[model samples]
Target chain A: DVKVTQSSRYLVKRTGEKVFLECVQDMDHENMFWYRQDPGLGLRLIYFSYDVKMKEKGDIPEGYSVSREKKERFSLILESASTNQTSMYLCASTTAGANTGELFFGEGSRLTVL
Target chain B: GESVGLHLPTLSVQEGDNSIINCAYSNSASDYFIWYKQESGKGPQFIIDIRSNMDKRQGQRVTVLLNKTVKHLSLQIAATQPGDSAVYFCAETGSGNTGKLIFGQGTTLQVKP
Candidate 1:
């Protein structure tokens, strides 16, 4: 079975603080993604990594950055957390090949920036 | 920019009843579609997917129907249960890019027992 685990399920952070969300996948997929879910916006892609040290900006990549030092781990960094950044963050992974864009996702990290 | 969208924001159905959710996409280039169900406090879960070559696909008690001409997609759940109550979204994908998906606004399904 594919296991995508998130380090923290819940967190409460103060404004202007730095936040880090960690994700690890056991399937050895090459593609990793970070998305933030809001009420009306659904899930907006923040950043994605296709390979180690390679990253691309998604639709909404502002105020966020990502790291992919290894194939199995992907981390999302919030430079200065604010109330607007408070939302549920999701991590997903997929194999690096020609196929359907089926993404296996982790449970999600719910952050509350105060 | 072209985007995927849903016809309604919420749908309510009684237990054992059938439910249908509709979505429309403005981009004709999109050839692949997927349906996702997201329970409260969880990420989206893949329910079923349909390609442009095929008109329909079924999985368990769920069915996905695609209409390329109109750029419309629908998901039908038979014998709906409380477990099926969640926000359902449709995503569109095509060749050429990084395989990233463009998702619809989403529809909330409520099952009454």
Candidate 2:
């Protein structure tokens, strides 16, 4: 079984504060993704890393950045947290092998910005 | 803009009945689709998937059907149980090799006993 773990399940931060969300996968997948899910808006991609040290901005990457220092870990950073930035953050990983391309996801971290 | 969307925002079903959720995608280039179930306060879990080449695929109790001509997708859960209650989202991937997926808004499924 593949396991994707997120460092925090819930977080609270003040406006303009810096926040970090961490995710780790044990399956050694090559692709990692960060997504923010909102009601009626769906899961919008924030950033993704296809390999170590390589990152790509997704549809909504503003005010967010990501880091991939190792194959097992991917981190998402909120440069300046704002009230509107509060959302359910999800981390996902996919193995490099198949065409099915199913992603294994971690339990999401719900961030609240006040 | 090219995107994936759900036909319904919510669906209610009685236990032991069959449930069907629908989604539509505007991107004809999408080659892969996946169905996910997300419980409250948790992340979405992969329920089943179907590729563009195949029109239908079945899992333990879930089936995914894809219609390329209409760019429509559906997930059918047979003998739906209370455990099946969740928000179901259909996601499309144009390039699986690159691991890019565009997800729909999602349909919340409510199971009644």
Candidate 3:
């Protein structure tokens, strides 16, 4: 079974604080993604990386950035957290050239910004 | 703008009965579609998927139907149980091999005994 592990399951941060969410997948999947899940909005992609040091903006990328320093590790960064940024963050990955549209997701990290 | 949407925000059904969830997509180029189930406090899990070349597909107790003419998609769950209660989301792959998926607002399924 493939496992995508998130560094934090729950986090609380004040406005203007920097936040970092880390994810690592055991499988050697080449693609990784960061998404924020909210009520009524479902899951909105923040950023995605197809290779190390390569990143692309998704539908909602205004308040987020991502880093893929290593193949298995992908990180999401919030330069300055805000109340509106409070939501559940999910990390997902799939094998390279996989067109099946199946993504293995992590358990998700719930972040609360005060 | 191209997007995927659900017909209902929630669906309630009695246990042992069949449940159906509907979805619509605006992009005609989308060829692959998927249905996911998200339990409370967990990430979405892949339930079933259908390709444009095929109109229907089944897995275990779940069946996915695609109607390209109407651009509609539906998931049917047989013998619904309490454990099947969760938020269901429909997603379509983006234009290319980008592996990006556009998801619809999920529909929450409630099972009654």
Candidate 4:
């Protein structure tokens, strides 16, 4: 089975601290994505990468950046964490070919910024 | 500004009954539509998907209907069970985009015995 794993399931960080959330997929999918899910508002895309060293901004990309140095891993970086940024983050991966747009997602990382 | 939306915020159904969740999209160019089920404290799981060319598709006990004329989508779950309770969301994908999904707000489905 395909597995997408997040580095941390639960994280707590102080305000203004830099934070990193890591995700690794064993499926070797070429497309990976980062999304932040909030109550009432559904999952909003933050950043996505199609290939190593290639990235694109999604709907809500402010205060967030992404890094993809390898094919199986994608990292979400928070330059300066704040209380408003506290939410559950999800990581997903998909194949690059013309098959369609089906995505396999990790469990998720719940972050709390104090 | 393109967006996807749900008609109802919540729905309740008794076990053994059918439940339907509705979604609408503003982008007519969207070619792919997908339905996802998200349980509390978990990520969204793919349920079923339908392409623009087809108006209906089925999988397991779930069926997805697409109305291109109105840009509306619906997911129907047969014989709803307690284990089927979750928030249902519909996502629309652009014709040329690669796996970039625009999701609706979502509808909370409560199944009662």
For all candidates, state DockQ relative to the true structure. 0.62, 0.68, 0.77, 0.62
Please write out the lDDT profile of model 4 over residues B1-113, one tens digit for every residue: 77899999999999999999999999998988999999987788889999899999999999999999999999999999999999998998865666799888899999989
Report, for all candidates in order, the number of backbone clashes: 0, 0, 0, 0
Over B1-113, each residue of candidate 2 has an lDDT whose tens digit, in order, gives: 76899999999999999999999999888888999999987889988888899999999998899999999999999999999999999998764355788899999999999
Candidate 3 per-residue lDDT, tens place, A36-77, comes to 999998899999999999999999899888999999999999
The TM-score of predicted model 4 comes to: 0.97
> Could you tell me which 10 consecutive residues in candidate 3 chain A have the lowest summed lDDT?
A94-103
Q: Which window of 10 residues has the lowest lDDT sum in candidate 1 chain B?
A: B93-102
- Candidate 1 per-residue lDDT, tens place, B23-48, comes to 99988877788998899877788889
Better of 2 and 3 by DockQ: 3
Q: What value does the lDDT take at residue A43 in candidate 4? A: 86
Question: Model 2 segments beyond 4 Å from truth?
Answer: A97-100, B95-97
Interface RMSD of 1: 1.5
By TM-score, the candidates rank as: 3, 4, 2, 1
For candidate 3, list the clashing residue pairs, or say none: none
Tell me the tens digit of each residue's lDDT in model 1 across A6-95.
999999999999999999999989999998888887788899999999999999999999999999999999999989999999999989
lDDT of each: 0.90, 0.92, 0.94, 0.92
- TM-score for all predictions? 0.96, 0.96, 0.98, 0.97
Each model's Cα RMSD: 1.3, 1.3, 0.9, 1.1
Off by over 4 Å in 1: none
Ranked candidates (lDDT, high to low): 3, 2, 4, 1
The per-residue C-alpha lDDT of model 4 at residue B13 equals 99
Q: Could you tell me how far off, in angstroms, the CA of residue A47 lies in candidate 2 after the best superposition? A: 0.5
